[model samples]
Target: MYAELFRLDGRVALVTGGSRGIGLACAEALGEAGARIAISARSRDEGEKAVRHLAGKGIEALYLPADISSESAAQAVVKQAAAELGGLDILVNNAGIARHGDSLDVKPETWDEVINTNLTGLFWCCRAAIETMVAAGRGSIVNIGSISGYISNLPQNQVAYNASKAGVHMLTKSLAGEFAKNNIRINAVAPGYIETAMTQGGLDDPEWSKIWLGMTPLGRTGKPSEVAAAVLYLASDAASYVTGSVLTIDGGYTIH
Candidate 1:
């Protein structure tokens, strides 16, 4: 009975930016757990390649090419995935970008780009997914937040990225409160120093790696799979009573 709660045989899930890294891992986890999967990303090539890889794993999946930075595009992808996959039972808002720049030196457009792509775009995807979820009377939405949302990173000037993730956390809680009556659950995962293409350069940098590992209680980089496991739990019936919570998977970095 406990194991059955994690099973999602007839459910459909949509993961934005699911072509690679953490997003891909999330897609794979959901699919392996028996949920029909659909992934959306900006790169058509990467999207197709990811779909092929999922096919190889025997997880039927769909690839929707879209830039979540556009509200229309975000909404369209959700609608398209729901139309194709039968209905939207789960949504993982993982499409985002980051940049390191001193607040004083950052351009207005740079700030806007990061905020728009990371925060506003995520909200747009949620709006579309929620509409479908409300109609269906049940849903789960998980946003990919960052450990930086809880604390500032050292040796990096990423005010915009930090701010955006903080927004994601609050938004998750706010939406959860508003939609719980609709039988929709919203949550977020805050990851720390996960091994991904986005963090490869920092991980390779001797100075950055030293600071990072030294701060983490685990003293190692986390895998995308580690984060995905948490996502899988939160997206499953096992977490039926859980919502508005931001599960932190940061190797104890935030404990400091």
Candidate 2:
């Protein structure tokens, strides 16, 4: 029954930013569960490499070049992936951008860039994915949020990044509420100080690491696979009744 509960044998999934870091981990995890994957990224080389990696694992992986910031591009990506993979059953909004700067020092251009990629791009992709999912009357969407959306970092500032992620949290809930009747599930995964390219800047800094570890109950950073596991659960039938939930993959940071 457990096998039947989580199996994704015939599903087609699209994971934005699937080339590396947390996104790649998720793509691999889902692929291992038997889903056909369409990995999207701005870099063609990285996208192809990711597809090769998934294929090496005996997963059907397709490379889709897309920058999720453009609404038309986002829709086109969904259409193309659906056409190539036959249909879409899951969407992981994993593409994001972060910039650290003083709230006062953050320029409008920088703020727009962060919001565009982190929040607006996510909306675009969701809209496109939802159009398809709504027609099919079933779908699952998982947005990758950040702990910064709830807690602030002291040593370095990322005002725009935090704002956009916070928006993502709200967006997830709103989308979930609106689409629940349509048999669509929307959720957000907020990760805290995970070991990934996004956190390399903070990881290399002793002061930042000290602060993060001091706040987290676990005393250590989380692995990409750990987060991927959470994503896999949320995307599977095991979580069929879960929706509008903000699943935190933090190392007990919020508990403290």
Candidate 3:
């Protein structure tokens, strides 16, 4: 039953930044696969809205609200998910912020906020989830990185975002080695120019859109569901032997 490998009947997954965009898609995918889902993010309104949407599809979902930029807040959401969901078997770190500017013109606060949310905060959530997973003797973690981590994007100067996502890729490898003994797996997905709210602005801009689509071999953007499918595969037993790897979904943008 190869398909059974992707089933998560008794698993509990905690998805950060699960209110919208790729995060929500990941939550829906995991939930549809039979995993009980708990999603956390800064916006309570959006969180509740996401939960309702999941419910409409007969998916059991909980929205745990928190601003993940703070270590305490990030850790609290992880712990809360474990307590509420009975145990945490999977963790998806999708909460990240992007601040695009020239390195010299970037505000100190802007850089701090992006790094705090995208890297440091993701690590905080992972650390807490690992603690519980270690006790449970098994777990999985899937991080949402970006193709920008591998190559700089054209027409946008997002130094902070690029650095943070690059760190995420390395961190995934580092932790994968550190925790393999505990039977915990860690991996990342590096997406390029997906059609999410976070990236829609670029797609809407004629200049940005032309360069973006032109550079991609596929000649178009990606859907959130495409990213979600990858996340679901990594989070399930389907990727049991996969760890410390970055799966790139870039529509051939990085091939060159």
lDDT of all the models against the reference? 0.95, 0.91, 0.95
* TM-score on alpha carbons, each prediction: 0.99, 0.97, 0.99
Against the true structure, candidate 2 has what lDDT? Answer: 0.91
Put down candidate 2 lDDT per residue, 1-256, tens digits, no spaces: 9877677899999999999999999999999998999999999999998888888888878899998888888889988998899889999999998899888998989988899889998998999899999999999999999887887766788989999999999999999999999999999899988888888988889998898888889999999999999899999998999999989988899886
How many pairs of residues collide in each model?
0, 0, 0
Model 2 lDDT-worst window of ten: 146-155
User: Which of the two, 2 or 3, has more lDDT?
Assistant: 3
Residue range 1-256, candidate 3, lDDT tens digits: 9999999999999999999999999999999999999999888899999999999999989999999999999999999999998999999999988877798999889999999999999999999999999999999999999998999889999999999999999999999999999999999999999999998888889999999999999998999999999999999999999999999999999999
> How big is the positional error of residue 175 in model 1, measured in Å on the Cα after superposition?
0.1
Candidate 2: list runs displaced more than 4 Å. Answer: none
List model 1 lDDT by residue over 1-256, tens digit each. Answer: 9999998889999999999999999999999999999999999999999999999999989999999888898889999999998999999999999999888999999998899889999999999999999999999999999998999898788999999999999999999999999999999999999999999989999998999999999999899999999999999999999999999999999887
By the TM-score metric, which is better: model 1 or model 2?
1
Q: Which residue runs of candidate 3 sit more than 4 Å off their true CA positions? A: none
Residue 17 of model 2, lDDT score: 92
Q: Measured by TM-score, how close is model 2 to the native structure?
A: 0.97
